[model samples]
Target: MSEAFEQYERKYCELSANLSKKCTSASLLDGEQKKQKLSEIKSGIDEAESMIRKMDLEARSLQPNVKAVLLAKLREYKSDLNNLKSGIKQITSNSLNAAARDELLESGMADTMTVSADQRSRLMASTEKLNKSSDRIRQGRKAMLETEELGVSLLQDLHQQRQSLLHADDTLHGVDDNLGRSRRIMTNMSRRMNRNKCMIGSIIVVLIVAISLILYFKLSK
Candidate 1:
């Protein structure tokens, strides 16, 4: 019975020592290992608490001499486990606060520059005005390009119309030359007809005079 109590006491002391070491070295562990170590520590704490309760009941049922020794060992075990738990709580709390501070520093939240509300408002208004000006400039450039395209199209149309007008003027000059040649041809034809008519009339008059001379001679004979 004494040997069993000694073994139980030694086992409890060994677990207490391991729990202390785990808590103290928690800061050196990486994220996943730290979490796993914490889980194991929590399980150890629960088992220790349960064992202390069982030992208390067992100690009460034992004889006075054995009960006294068992109670003393049980008290020591419970005290050591409680102290280990307190240390673990303090370490975890400190670690959490340190991590929070580091996160704030890394995100620039802790070292952010303070700006006055008036200055912020003025900056926003200036940005909006710049955007509006840029939009207007873009629209103006687009309108100018469209005007240039329309001017080019108008110039091209004027050039085409001028070419058509030039071609029409050339055609009209050719028609005028043809009309003048036709008029001269008609004038020459009329002059030739008048000369033929005068020649025929002269011949008829000569024949009539000759015939009258002949008729007079015959009558006298």
Candidate 2:
């Protein structure tokens, strides 16, 4: 595993330890302070939970024994996180109930109001519809964002490919220019070679004619 993963694991462990300590000490505080402490601990547990999950994913590349140990730790962390969340929910429920009761007593209205079954059913149905519509809207927005990102990435890749092609074309042009110059030099050398061959042939013919004339004159004398 990477050092970053190890650091995240260590941070999660430290946060879990701090959360445990905070939970133990929170009961000693007064109402508002206890709620505040619990909130802080809940935030820490949430952060730790995220880190633990990330570590769990990162641990897949580790040895089997190490992965098993990390998985066990992840499961323990998850259980603890669930417990912390349940505790927070209970605390919030209790606080709300306490506040409502106090307010009713202070207002001299101890009676509670109850909704009819039909009304409750209708309210639930309306809330469900609203939630479904919200979820659809959220999903649509997420898809649009993903598509936009993909398009941008594709455009960037295309731009890079175009630049590479242009570079290749320029290089080919340079090669063509060099080849043309080489061909011209070869043509010039061929012409010069032909001229030199002709001059050498003429010199040999003149020397042969001079030797023949001298031999004929000596024989005749």
Candidate 3:
């Protein structure tokens, strides 16, 4: 049991370190690269989590004393895993937000902050749901042991969700980039039209002044 605990601790530490490194390094990549790396990291984390869970179940099925110590260690590892995963999610989200901003910038779209109230509301609602889900997972860890199928299903669902978000984000950024280019072209065209209008106005004013002078001279003569 001691040997098993030691092995678990070592593996948990390795996974934690890997997760931390991935999270810290995420900010260094571009949007596409960020998305790719984050997906890979998430997959790795899921594998590590599954391993830890299996180890925990095996340890908990032992003698009472061994079970108690193993359970405590498992709890510690689970807590650390949760924290690391949360950090990874946050970093990934921040990367996506930054990518959105970059798309806005590249598109020459001014007032990126002018998001609709409805969009803002939806974002807030999503955030609340995420928080609630996190809390529920934390509370349900003990009971989650028996429901291994649930965990598997949950992972599949989450994988699908993440992939959907990635696709949506990429699509949105592409639209934003196109829109930005259009906005810049329109602005240039508008400036040119304004300049042409001014030139035409100046020409018309000069002709009127010349005609008035000629008429005045003829009348005076």
User: Of the candidates shown, which would achieve the greatest lDDT relative to the real structure?
Assistant: 3
* lDDT, candidate 2, 100-198, per-residue tens: 765776797764433234334434443454344334434544554465466557667978999999999999999999999999999999999999999
Ten contiguous residues with the weakest lDDT in model 3: 115-124
Candidate 2: stretches off by over 4 Å: 1-124
lDDT of 1 by residue, 59-118 (tens): 777777557655655655665666667655654554565467557767876642432343
List the pairs of residues colliding in candidate 1: none
Off by over 4 Å in 3: 2-5, 111-221
In Å, residue 12's CA in model 2 sits off its true spot by: 40
Instruction: Encode model 3's per-residue lDDT on 1-221: one tens digit a residue.
Output: 45665576567667766756665555455568878878878987887787687777778778774566567657756776776677666666666666676677679774646533433554455455445544554455445444444544666797899999999999999999999999999999999999999999999999999999999999999
Per-prediction TM-score, please?
0.44, 0.43, 0.47
Task: Give the Å error, residue 197, model 1.
Answer: 99
Error of 2 at 214 (Å): 2.5
* 94 Cα displacement, candidate 3 (Å): 0.9
Q: Specify the poorest-scoring 10-residue window by lDDT in model 2.
A: 113-122
What are the lDDT figures for the candidates, one per model? 0.64, 0.64, 0.69
- Rank by lDDT, highest first: 3, 2, 1
